[model samples]
Target: MDPLGDRVNRNGTPTVSDPSPGSEGGLALSGTRTLLLTTFTHVLVDGYGIGLSVLLALLFGRNGRFALVGLILSAYTLATAFAEPLWGRFSDATGRRGAVVGWGLVFASASFCAFGFVSPEGPWAGPLLILFALAAGAGAGTYHSVATALVNEVTSRENRGLVQGINNAGGSVGRTLFPLALAELAVVLGSPGWAVLPFAGAGVLLGLATVSAFPLASPRTFRAGTASPSPDGPMDRRFLARMVALSFLRTAFFVTAAGFLPTYLVAVRGLDERAMGTVMTLVMSTGILAQPLGGSLSDRLDRGRLLAGLLAGSGAAFAGSLLMEGLWSSVALLGISMFMVLMTFPLLFALMGDVVPGNRLGAATGLVTGAGGLAATLTQATVGVLAQRTSPVLVLLGLSALGVLSGWMAMGLRAPRSPGGRRALGS
Candidate 1:
């Protein structure tokens, strides 16, 4: 058999060579089990995290609300951005991915419950809310980086792409749906506070489950065997820089779209509130299918090229939105743009895993995520300023240009080769 394509056991199925520690009699559960547990946890935690965005409206006032929201959101983003690397490095040191995720969920959930007590009328309310945002953002940030590292750890490179796709889809579902669900609950419950209680409750329950999921301090997990050859070359600083640039571009695209799309729909397109909501929903929901499809393709194709192509597609779709007329045409173009953009996430993450050493997965993930967040924050602020000076359409066009530039950067990145001249596990 050609080892360069994929590693297979005697029966010709790809499986981890050795049984994970604690499996009964050397019988490890299939990667399916790994994907299920991790993905479930991801949905719950990420749902809760995204739900915080909804809470911002409930927690602040109409007067000075925009400024206050901006301040708190910036605090949250900064907290998450800075905390990712620290928690990632800590996970690498302890090799306790589950525990890290568990604690992160606990603290994040507690922050939600704390919000219930905050009186928006009181002077202390705004300060307390900012603090909560920071804490919640920190926890969610920690959970995100470590959990991704854990996913890469348990799956072979040959199968990692699909697993990441599934994993990303789960998180995207949580992020997209949770806020809408909360809005619906708010209508039925007649108070935003009552609506938010379920999120806190779910977080607590999920936190306990995370604790149980990691009974042993350490479990046997996917690791490169001694018989495997070393990476073809040392980590390249230039390659790292390329990744950071790509991440920045990706984040900028998302933040700008999310920040401005609603305004554009209402102001430029003459859409009513109902139509605007529908368009936004369609944009996010497209990712549920797009992510998995992209991941599956990444497994069979060159990841770098796939990412570049996706970015280029996203840019073209964004350009389409500029020229398209009528409601359906705009929706279709924007949806395609979202699909193309969101699909790049799993591919970019898988590429990062392939380029770095296994032991350093947590730190590497943290560095890129953190740096990307910071860069995106700066870029978004610049766009906000630009939007004030120019038209929203103009601002969006500039952001789309960034996407094309990012695709070019991705095109220049080297695909790391796995041992035996095959694709890297990250590929």
Candidate 2:
């Protein structure tokens, strides 16, 4: 209980909001629309995120330029790692999710346009490049964290698993198609000199999504102070231990897939960005189909067991990918391996919904994402150096081991149910 207007009568208190009953169909629809728009935005933004590196290659055209491309590739995740928990807590504390999201769009949109000023030969280019990285990352970080929180805020536990599939699928859809589209756009726009228009369009889409999310109904704040502990004893300690380690292994594998695998193709086999993007599109698009399959599989199958089985399969696929004798065969095997890699994400998100308490869901998700991002950043640099000295097969071998480790770790997790088969954790 809280006093009205800070009573000074020898007492201290805080006001709490009353729980709102009933769902707003409009808000749910609006959230759905926002997510759909977000998918489109993600494709373009991630297009800018990853494609910017290839574009920069055109600008610099130097061997050391790979370092610049690497920075561009890594910066988004690094920024998101630092910001997710902060934004999650902020959204939790204030309940101004829409406002936070709207403002995030403003920052992201401006940063996109501002990124055009980062020229290699200009006097201020070096510092401007750093600023572009910092701003793009910070803004993108805020938008994504808040958006994820909002998805949970509106969806019921019954549907969280399905929606997790949907969200990740949305992202896959974006990344899958966006690169091909942007590659064409880059050509039409004559990038490396003037490429601000595509980023500007992405910024506008973000703005539209943010504005349409207004009029969202406020959520019924859960009883955080009084909710009973999970029946699965020592929830926080056990779940955190399971999730953090799994997140690290999961992210480490993805970094290896995206960074080392591509570099291996280029260094050992000599393929360029266009060729790599073609393969990336196929791999990502498969997940648009595979994630729903994974989520449905999670419902019917033992999630932990399924994860283990998939990893063993995935590791074998990647290992075989390394041994391919020709370029065409290499691409085929890598595509299959990458598809296997993509299938894991929805299951992971669904598993989070299974294990974490609904009350503290945002924080828990943020922590998992942050841990993964940290691992990814470290893995990319390590694999890059590893590729320089040893054979590419060695890095693939290491990732194969990581996949096996991830499966073992997945085997350690058991999603328990409450007395009524209701997941107290599922958001």
Candidate 3:
């Protein structure tokens, strides 16, 4: 009569089995409820992350120092990248994924709010800004690995891609909405710090809500010791190496292109702040549809091929954008690129779940995402310095080249084997 209908072996110990589609231990909060909660949290947290760009733009103004901007951006990105594996390891060890998600959001939100209050011109602003950025990044870093691991714990393999896609789309929603919301707040409040108050407050509330919902969403069966190893066997190191490399390249491209897109719009294309925010919103909005479509396709088609094609398509679209003369036309092309780029995230997450053991999922995810973060940090810093010497457009074009290379590299990923089959790679 164990909850979850867990079967017992001859020794009377519970035998490991996948959580049945949605319910974990017959808990009130089904997989659907957990998905919903995680998705909402994703919106707020990712919104804050993307919204930082808008805040940075506001604080620095149109003609501000690109070099300094890059450094500060790198600080956050680097810390986030560095913290991912640590947080992932912690989640795996403690069986407290909910605590990680809830507290991380609260800590990041508080730090971000504090960041808004510091004057850019103040004598201590440089040190203070970097410190806050590090704090916020570390807190934000705790999110994806744990939340995703939580989602996958309850979802069946058949639905994992779709569920992850929906979860990722929530991030897209945040990325899309936050920029405009923050921009509007900036216009109304006229103080960058005060503008962040509303969003930060929302994040704090969401974090508390997550903490309260933990017991219902996470049952003991889903905890570390209760779960068993994946039948897929130990992960292939070579395949993991390939994935990490792919993640690095894609992230570097994304960070370079999207990170500087707003600046490119304002400085290179001559758009006003409001207009830039609108275009940014439009670009990210594409992900809402693209992610689900990509996820659904991955379930039926070859994930490796789909991923390669998407990366190539994204790269082609981005390259095409550079050739366009008119601003709107270029924006249209860039929007398509953004669409395809966003689609790849859930695919990557789903791919990891397919091979990695249940208990090690968090750590593996952390490593993959952490690699991407590291790439982003380096790319952001490098491009920031290079932007001073050349146009942001050229810098973006160079980054777009990395996408094509990533696509080529993605072609090497073996399809994930079915459960009870031999491992997917190095077989």
Candidate 4:
């Protein structure tokens, strides 16, 4: 009998298997414990790490200049985009994933706390804010890709999808709650910069503490059964290029549409700021759940086919939103589209994980994520310009076209073997 439970059947479900004594297959408790801890780490890192955007709003107050805000945000995002791949390569070379993550949190948290010290009255305020933004960006880059690789290392293939789903869900929770928490804290403190300091510091301390405990809790060695060493063990540059291209296109579609959705609703649907915010919230809330659902489904189904279907559905929904007349109809279609778009997050990365060698998971993740970020930045700018010169609907139609292209790319993805010598899907 196979010791790692059973061989996955045609439907991707495992059948019955007998395990030897002390086998890794029975260590579900330890694996799950590790997963939960990792998930919590993501919450702290991603939740507060993304607070720079919120911080920008607080810095400018009611008279926020779009150009200035965009400049600083662009710096932050680009810094993150550029740094991810480097961190991934560093982690792969050093084999000190925990140390990288712990130190990264420290750097990010310090950047957040530093925000409190930058006075609006000071002449150096803008420059100081930019410095902290870049620091935060670097920290964000370090945390996510390393954490993803760590999770992939610890979990078995049978459960990786579910666990990664949970991981993505944790990030969503952070993204949803952290900004609101920071905003409320700003109200109480009457200083936007100072408001996030306490929370950021607390997160830092907690993260460091968690890292300290990792040595005791983490698996002694990555289980050999989970992945096999690659035959050549060399990077597949062509596959990486394709992944980067596809990721860029998909991320561009999401970032452009989301960045402009509020404006579109206000201009086209005549909704006020508050109502638009409500609609936006409604759309984002669905994403929190959609990621996990998508991941779980990807694990059970063929990832390429599943991803293609999702993108196509999203495109169809997006097109419907453009054509729909009523506000409710538009909201329903757009919300569904947004949910499908967000769901692609885990599926795409997990697909990469399947193809990427275990030793280079970090680098692969970093490269794709960084490229995607850069694409999002460019796409947002392009969409903004187009909206100014043409119409919001026209820009969205273009985005829908990109979505279709992305789906085609996903459909063209080749099934690659895991490090454990397992095919991604049954033949």
Question: Which candidate has the top score in TM-score?
Answer: 3
RMSD of each: 6.6, 6.4, 4.5, 7.1
Of 1 and 3, the candidate ranking higher by lDDT: 3
Compared with the true structure, all predictions reach lDDT values of: 0.68, 0.59, 0.78, 0.68
lDDT of 2 by residue, 30-113 (tens): 345545644555545444454444444444433434444445546656776777667766765655555566666567657766
Q: How would you order the candidates by TM-score, starting with the best?
A: 3, 1, 4, 2
Q: Model 1, range 261-327, lDDT digits (tens) per residue? A: 6556655676544455456667778878888888888988889898998898898788778777767
Which consecutive 10 residues in model 3 have the weakest lDDT in total? Answer: 222-231
Can you write out model 4's per-residue Cα lDDT over 321-419, one digit (the tens) per residue?
Answer: 998888888889988997897788778767766667877888888999898778876766566556556776876788888787788888877767655
User: Against the true structure, what is each candidate's TM-score?
Assistant: 0.82, 0.78, 0.89, 0.79
Top candidate when judged by lDDT against the true structure: 3
Off by over 4 Å in 2: 1-49, 52-68, 109-130, 143-145, 192-196, 215-218, 221-235, 260-267, 389-393, 421-427
Better of 2 and 4 by lDDT: 4
Alpha-carbon error at 269 in model 1, in Å?
Answer: 6.3
> Over 4 Å off in model 1, which ranges?
1-31, 48-50, 54-69, 113-126, 218-234, 259-277, 322-325, 385-390, 422-426
How many pairs collide in each candidate, listed in order?
A: 3, 0, 1, 4
The TM-score measured for candidate 3 stands at 0.89
- Superposition error at 198 for model 4 (Å): 4.4
